[model samples]
Target: MRERNVVSAQTQLLSTVAPSQSPSFDPDLGVITPPSNGMARSAFARPVAPRARWRRRYLACLVLIDFVTALGASRTVVALLDEADAGFWDQRVLGGAVSAFALVTNLVVPLMWMTVLVAAGAYDRRALGRGTEELKRVARANVAMAATVSFLALGFKKDLSRATVAAIILTLLLYTLVTRALARVVLRRIRRVSQRASQKVLLVGRLSDAMAVHEVVTRNPGAGLRPIAIHLPHHPRPGERVTAPVPVYVGWDLVPLVQQLGADTIAVCGPASLESYELRKLAWQLEGTGLDLVVVPQVTDVTGPRIHVRPIEGLPLLNVEEPTISGLSLLVKSMLDRVTALVGLVLLSPLLVGIAVAIKLTDPGPVMFRQTRIGHEGRAFKVWKFRTMYTDAEQRLEALRHRNESDGLLFKIKDDPRVTPIGRHLRGLSLDELPQLINVLKGEMSLVGPRPLPTEDDDYRGDVRRRLLVRPGITGLWQISGRSDLTWEDAVRLDLHYVDNWSLVYDLGILWRTASVVLARRGAY
Candidate 1:
């Protein structure tokens, strides 16, 4: 009877506590989770997932492992530099002709070591995920760090032979890249196993808001959150916990129920007095006792770069800024678009001609295909491509609409019948998009931007239309990120991320990566 009375009272208190702040605004909007139901109505659109949160212990462990591994790798490189008699190791060795230590206690080596780690972002919690990009980042950071060390060594001391440094650099680069890749694979595997043993969390919040958080953690299961309870703050009392018999006492005896349940995490859905200082104090009281407190909002697909946290009058104020492509930098972007596109068109003219001939022979179509697509400012422009389909491809589109495998407003079929034999080959090699260079030169497109959607007026939400802020790209963050394999939201997020953080350095990086991705053919079809 006492337990029942307590439960009834707790439910009544929860029913009355008002949730604070806006219910729908996303703090960051680029990294949200996609809808699991899978149909997308827009070419480029933000996700429904919250930005990922990670376990501090796991992150700290990964960082420590990476740091030690890097130090050891650095030491091995240094030892090799010492052992190589051909002035390779001897020069870079502490007392040798190539040493950076002539100035201090291997200060340069240590600085190089730290810089390499930092540049690789091995310390970042987000990079713990097993992905090609994470490994690439680590490899790039190590290479850049070693290169900095070698170049600085050479510049400071003329007696230093570049050959020794070069050899050591190449050897270390290969070793480090391979080593990091293997380590990530293993760590991720181990993390997966550990995730299976993760403590289950029961969350209660607004239906839509809670659903977003649920999907986010569920999608990235390795993050170690297994949500088992879902109480709707709007509903006051939840039916029951999903995986365990945990009682969630909201408002009244909330602290006591949390204590009794021995929950590892309590992710309150909305900001109520229950989620305020008292909740934080509850978190503090439970800290050493092993319970984690989490508060997730409806922030969808937002990245940290887009969300700025400011301190105003003792409150944690959030500033969500609008991103745009402007200033003199657009000039640089334009210049790069023109130069790369012109060079691409010039070098590929022979191949283009060959493809054109093949398409003509096979499909009996015009040498070029032009389609109207939405561009920067939502303006319509004709996008050009080497004709890789029958001239009547548009007329046959209706039959393939249902066959569209792409999960968005975009239409694509893995074995599209409209693709002539030659066209399929060209698309596989990304050669069909070659004529887009002319569009770049004509100011209707760029070498990189969000993939443009056709201008036939497919309906889109206001959030989905933001990709039009920049000219459509022949190849872009989306193209290199996954191309056809990317979900609609991923494509949109990558596009928006690029637009928000446009930089000349990033463009050059993308171009360089684009070459590798083309050769690798990660998402051609």
Candidate 2:
């Protein structure tokens, strides 16, 4: 009897809350929408909303940039070749002046380049302004353009200058990449300042799942998803309070709620209450709404390169590839690390000498500090760095243990009296760690990887041991993210993430960002 009363109350609530021509609802199938009142129009029939205008404008800007880059590159290369060889375009071919052929070729090249890029999905809105996928697509499109040009030249029996063609392709690739990267920088700046630039997302799932999704969104502000509200399947019991930053709503009929909130996206995070049929019904209701639906998967800490989507019949399956910890990539990384370390040590020799002299003058201690650290596969190696602390700093450590700032096994203090006056400046600018290049050169460390801990702090068990799979590094995700300022848990999480998703591209990105982080002195001593 109570169940029937509850059902009656829910029906009455829906009737009172929804519009007069609201979609039909089923007790089992959830909110089912009929084709009446334009609720079920084709996706193409929907008009573009004001919120989506920015995407179209951005796309147009990219197209213009790419077209200009291609034309400019071809023109510049051709002009340079013409200057070097006066008769470059003088030879007549196919009953027309070669100059005319060259003119036509210049115009046709950019068009062909644009067409190939469009076919390769280089300008996909979802990939723009984030991730390495956009750059990869652009690279693939450039390769395709080169191949097409070569095939056409050979098939037509035309003696095209290979140098000019190669130069044009290479120049276009470099220019387009630079322009796109700059565009992303500008877009990120704008989105950071104006919340209106981001997509208003309505989270729909259990409270825990919604909170997890919120945390992920918070961590990645560049994703541009601003959580407006959370919609749960049922009402909270008395004394139960939601701690999420967004407002909370109850009930399964989320279309009207989403519309009312003016949310442009709905993020369904492992909806426990919605069955397959109900989920489909919800999608049906949003067919002509011009809204984006993002279903967040349960997977965590995995990147796009490792995940593959395979569909069988009508079911979509996600296949995650194993992490690459060995093979040719590691060999390349090792060679690069040693080569870079050698060059850095040679170039910075003068600065290193000056620092050594200053350290000798400031305090009475050794110029270099070497401490045993846990390395790959539980091996121990003496890591090298410029001495920044007093000679008796270790002896005085126990007295300061009670005042340690870190919550985990690592110990850190924002302003330690043990540091010498000159040491403070070196630590702040990250110059104190320059000596570690020797370790990198010696194969005891890498240019980029998880930071190795001292021997006493080594707890190589469970997932923590994964950090030992590769050589320790002087700088890593932890360094670029937040050095000593990060909590132990956050630091470990970042280290593990780098270990599981390490790539040459990823290493380069971290190295690039490290310079900015060091300049800003973020989370430094």
Candidate 3:
């Protein structure tokens, strides 16, 4: 399919060529070309020197710091070993003096660790300023290096001290990760304050597609993709600027535009609907230019691990792995949820008792509120929470239905009349939901999953119901992003995204973000 499209584009380009010679036209391909070297030099408005230099300098400094950190960790390990009792674990490893072993481990091992990091592509420019991926690679590289070294020592029958080797490897891994994290923080700060550190991006797509990408990049400054302008292939009005979230340009004379904006990257979205051949030709034209080309697929909210590309013949096929429904991973998730919930209930028993007493005193009603809610696999369960409303709150719900401010099947208001004063405080702090830990212990809920809906709400069907495949949670993406504040569509989108991409690491990250959001009390009511 891609090859045919490319061939079709080539055929179409032949018909558009001018009869006479033109500077921007390629005679062999019969296609319009980018600006010639002399024209680009004359028309180029922005210079790329400063930004390129800043990027290179930052990468170099980061690599140097990481290597230095490895050395420091190695030295500390050696110092600790030197101080240990002589008879206590053989100071005579390698059949030599402690100083001799120290020299080799401190110098040689640190160098090997640094080499491993470089070989792992930790210093690649594409990875710079990116989050988590780089750190993950750093840790992986250290682990691989440790395993290789340990294996070699055992195979060669070398008299290496296991205690010293283990200590040094552990220290090196810890030191490298801490230093890289700190470095990322400083570099991200610099990227925000220094224009030269940010990568200028030129988006090519429809207004809506470009705007979507623009919003994501703007929201995540750490991504470092600063949108300077957008190019609309099918501009409604030629030679007229369209005011989008950013400046939108028309027509396909992209080389001069790229030069003018000094863009470091050109991000093309699929919605532009360019022929495969045209995109290939554009990439060819950009070969000599320093701009990096990034293709943004139309598929949204998919994680990197699930999306795979397989090139067959001349076409690239995207294969999206189905989300895991039942596996060892699910078992791990269940175990963690139950263990954490049990421990939390025990630890917070005193606080829970106090909350129960307060609720009973204030409302003179049930301390616990029980309501039927949907759970995994569409199972109905009685969800538990500390009662936050009056005894007759359910009866008055129909009268207050017209006051619903929350969108979708969920009904909520900023200041619901049913909520008692104590209830309002508890809701604000999310303390009212603490009793749901019992649900997690009972295996009716998870620590992190989609929000369970009330049994009365039957608005979900089709893909939306897939959220039921996993155990519902007390808090999830919906809670961390915005609870009642998010629109119905956005809330479902986030929940579905989590359903498809949930992993142990991903869950941990969400949990960390959840902590901060809970404290800030943003969008809680």
lDDT, candidate 3, 140-245, per-residue tens:
8988888888888889988777887788888888888888878877877776677447788988887778878888778656667788767777736434333454
Quote the positional error of residue 334 for candidate 2 in Å. 1.9
Best by TM-score: 2
The best-first sequence of candidates by lDDT reads 2, 3, 1
CA lDDT scores, all candidates in order: 0.62, 0.80, 0.78
Total backbone collisions, model 1: 16
**Tens-place lDDT digits, model 1, residues 1-525:** 544543444344344333431112111211111123423233233222222233455556555555455455456655665576466544446466444444332344444555676767865544655455566676777678666766776788746546645654565456556666665556555557776434456575554455567776776565556775455443233443212122232222333333333345667765542446655554555534445567664454554456778998867676776664787888878987898778988998898788777777776648888888888887788989888777778899987788888876777778888777777778887988888889998889988777888855445457677788777887788888678888887777788777776667667668767987888877886
Model 2 C-alpha RMSD vs. true structure (Å) is: 6.6
Compared to the true structure, candidate 2 yields what TM-score? 0.86
Q: Which candidate, 1 or 2, has the higher TM-score? A: 2
Candidate 2 — which residues are off by over 4 angstroms?
Answer: 1-50, 86-106, 271-273, 455-458
Q: TM-score of each candidate?
A: 0.62, 0.86, 0.81
Q: What are the clash counts of all predictions, listed in order? A: 16, 0, 0
lDDT of 2 by residue, 1-525 (tens): 544443454455345444655544344422223224534424344433236667788889989988888888888877887789887655445457776767655678778889999988898866787757888889999999899989999999988878877998898899888888888877777787775457888898888899888987877676678887777766565656444455555653566566656678888887485677767776776777777888887877888589898999977788889999999999999999999999999999999999999999989979999999998778888989899999999999999998899876687889998999899899999999999999999999999999989855356777888888888998999999889989888888899999889999999999998999999999988
RMSD of 3: 8.4
